[model samples]
Target: MRIEVNGTPRDIAAATVADALSELGWGEARVATALNGDFLPAASRPMQALRDGDRLEVLAPMQGG
Candidate 1:
């Protein structure tokens, strides 16, 4: 499947959000995820189904001001 991740095009073979994250190499890292401009909670990731051309944003915490 093809999707835009963090504004870049990526080819991912995943059926769910959790699988996608893992495929992206996130692997248990602390981060936030949004799909199609909507925020998704951590608990919902495993069951969230993704479709073609979906926009996914994975954000990590930023420190220092």
Candidate 2:
């Protein structure tokens, strides 16, 4: 399946958000995620199913305030 991640097109074979994260090498990284412009909680990633053409956004925290 193909999904947009952070504005980039990516082809991935994943069933859930967690699977996508793992495939993107973010399995254990702390980050914020939104699917199709909706916020997706960390706890729900494991069950959040993804489909083709879904837009996913992942943002990692940065400290410097």
Cα displacement (angstroms), candidate 2, residue 27, comes to: 0.5
Q: Encode model 1's per-residue lDDT on 1-65: one tens digit a residue.
A: 99999999999999888999999999699999999999999899999999999999999999999
Q: Between which residue pairs do clashes occur in model 2?
A: none
- Per-residue C-alpha lDDT of model 2 across residues 1-20, encoded as one tens digit per residue: 99999999999999999999
Best by lDDT: 2
Shift in Å, residue 52, candidate 1: 0.6
Q: What shift in Å separates residue 54 of candidate 1 from its native position after superposition? A: 0.3
| Number of the top TM-score candidate | 2
Score residue 2 of candidate 2 by CA lDDT: 96
Error of 1 at 46 (Å): 0.3
Ten-residue region with minimum lDDT total, candidate 2 = 10-19
Q: How accurate is candidate 1 locally (lDDT)?
A: 0.95
TM-score of each: 0.96, 0.97
